[model samples]
Target chain A: MSKALLQNEVIILDELDRQIIQATQSGLPLVPRPYHHVAEDLGVTVKEVIRRMKAMKDTGIIRRIAAVPNHYALGYKGNGMTVWDVPSELVNDLGHKVGVLDFVSHCYHRPRFLPDWPYNLFAMVHAHNRKEALLLVDTIAELLGKHDRGHDVLFSKQILKKTGMRLL
Target chain B: MDDLDRKIINLLQEGFPLTEEPYADVAKQLGIDESGLLSRLKSLLDEKILSRFGPMYDAAKLGGDFSLVAIKVPKDRFDEVAGIVNSYEEVAHNYHRDHDFNMWYVLATESPEKIHEVNADIEKRIGLKVFNMPKLDEYYIGLKLTA
Candidate 1:
């Protein structure tokens, strides 16, 4: 486990937590007082279900629970995974800038394997089309003055499956 | 959910009980009748919004390969390739990306040959190389939003 996890002492998840995570991930039913239904199914009280979910967030097991919306279903078509060869010294700064961009939904700084894959900073841009998506990436690169850096633009060819995590 | 929908998703997620009167069992707990709950569930699934309300076979348990693939479709022919690529039932969620290898998509297939065949076909049809990136390791936040 990462030192961060050890230091935080995240309680190792138990059966109840695992089942509860599975129940929520599958999709909450659309009805009045959903928690009541969830609680009954798990052989627990509605209040208990709420309490456990709350504890998950409190203890950092869960970040947040909200609708996992599908961007494609909403008709915003252009989505791209982009990589940038940010210098090791500037990776942290560039990663922050990339993360703050509205179109860049996800960003990370991965190790830059030299000679083969030199690009370390990765950013994802979602937009309406190639022109708009590329425009966002280009602008970010320009602002960072790393436009000359080696990068790859990976546009999605197809989506084989879209699923949430299974707690089992 | 206000009340009932929550019960249904919870039941499905927990792995639907095998007994014939599973609905009744669930209803007894929720203080409702089985028939009404079943009917409501049928509607939610029909909406296509609930992609699935069923158990997913464990991929690792079955020894399956799960990977995300990306390719660059020429700007002029994005629509054409998308149509051909999406035709395969294997392609689930696809989008046009902005990078040089413009097209990206996820592929989940059991055997390596099946995956390789997909690339071969896409290349033969579109005349572009697919950057097949197998997941060396996964660092996930579990990325599921629990509401």
Candidate 2:
């Protein structure tokens, strides 16, 4: 896993990799030496665990190893999915600019349905309240400028279900 | 969250070190003892301030396809439709948003083609169009909320 070539290339997950992910999927234990705990449990070594994690990160398989704060608990009670109907020709350049905004969290260029749906750009925004979220949407609106044909913010009313991915 | 907890959240979001003793490394950087740092993290989790703390995997890179699907479910049948949608293992999360296209959910499938199959299946069963909006380009995909 420490090999530079392996780090730079995308590698498929072997049995060992899958086992390690399953073991730590929920989370690494809250201990002083977390990797050592995982290694000991898996009968490998601390170095192996760290190396594999590094490889995963480098290859973009693992986005990051960090804390995911609860936005609601952290005072970001308002959450809205701001969708834009930008011309397909200018979406690539416009998407890049919208994605870099401090308030936009997850930005992507998605497809639009015909007749009724026309938005192709989606950006999830968060703020302390709906007002603030709308204001953030305003900032994005200003950024989009003339390129933005139309837009709407869909505020989340209820979370029907919330769970992380489960490897099947 | 108090001052120290705020500091911990802010710093941890930036990233945790990947050293021999990562927690100890973080503790030293935060001017706290290893045990104290561990205890604080445990409390944060117990209190649900931090929903999760671990590696965030990219499903697409892991040989899976993810999509944001929306349905314009009728208001009278929303609950029934939600139940039907949530019953599938492919559905990662479902949310009810205030809009004409109200029901939105994320689908994670073993293969890219499975996404369309699942969408068609759901459409046939629920009698509504499943708008499959797979990401064409991902510009950014991280959220860092300052505590």
Candidate 3:
């Protein structure tokens, strides 16, 4: 973990910052002066809006200011939440390896619910179809080798709700 | 998406400049005028090709608690349970997966205690156990899916 992430100190946001998030959370305006639009909406100067956003970005709250493509629309129709039942001691190492794979988007070490759920590691893989998804899973299995304890891929039946995040 | 559209998606994912004239800066790199790039982006978003086009915030870093909770809603009650679960403002993303633990959703709350509170309230309402799986460690997160 990076030092900044490990601090465990909760960075408090002032009212202005909250307003900025509320204004831009849905999306940034697609104008020539996008920040200017946000500034105008929040009743702040363009420079202040830019300054606060930059500060938030530096602190890691803003992971990145970028375009998040819909994997499905990009021809990656298949999506799988692949979970692994590797030894707890080896999970961190295995997770880092799986995470770096080009096809894997998000990977994390989460707690396991015994008996019902033995998987402790989760990685989301995307592909054009189920066949391709399985092939990518095979690559992960190959990398894991013996350390690959039993694992299962849960394909999403439907997206019940997918609002990224709402700070209401 | 055309060749230019694909190029824009690929380039923008890397990161957008936070400059005064950020769009113009990016347009220069893509060899397109600022207006053209803006129109393409608008169309992409209008078509839902790009789910979002802005800063992706980390709730934890912003002093909020989050967790991935799963529940085994009886097949008959799937939609009913989903409705009750989605009613909460804290439930950010919910999905129906092909597993015994069928319903999975993310809960984001302003305080750590709220994670449990919300889970307990949902369990009480739905009469189903909620398996709260908060991240023990984050190995990696961001990835650029090539267009």
lDDT of each: 0.59, 0.87, 0.89
- The prediction achieving the highest TM-score against the true structure is 2
Give the best candidate by DockQ.
Answer: 3
lDDT per residue (tens digit) for residues B1-147 in model 3 = 899999999999889988888999999999999999999999999998898899888777766778999999899999999999999989989999999999999998987789999999999999999999998888777757888
Model 3 chain A worst lDDT window (10 residues): A1-10
Q: What stretches of model 1 exceed 4 Å from their correct place? A: A1-8, A146-148, A161-164, B1-147
Docking class of 3: medium
lDDT of 1 by residue, A1-168 (tens): 222343566365667766776676676554545667777788987767777766766665554443222445334467777888867777777677767766676676655445545666667777777778888878877867943377777776555334444434
lDDT of 3 by residue, A33-124 (tens): 98999998888899999999999998887889999999889998889999999999999899999999988999999898898999999999
Q: For every candidate, what share of the true interface contacts is present?
A: 0.11, 0.81, 0.83
Chain B TM-score, candidates in order: 0.71, 0.96, 0.95
Show model 3 residue runs off by greater than 4 Å.
Answer: A1-7, A10-12
lDDT of 2 by residue, B1-147 (tens): 798899999899878776778888988888999999899999999999999898887777776778899999999999999999999889999999999999999998887889899899999999998899888887887777889
Please state the error at residue A94 of candidate 1 in Å. 2.0
Give lDDT: candidate 2, residue B55: 80
Which candidate's lDDT is highest? Answer: 3
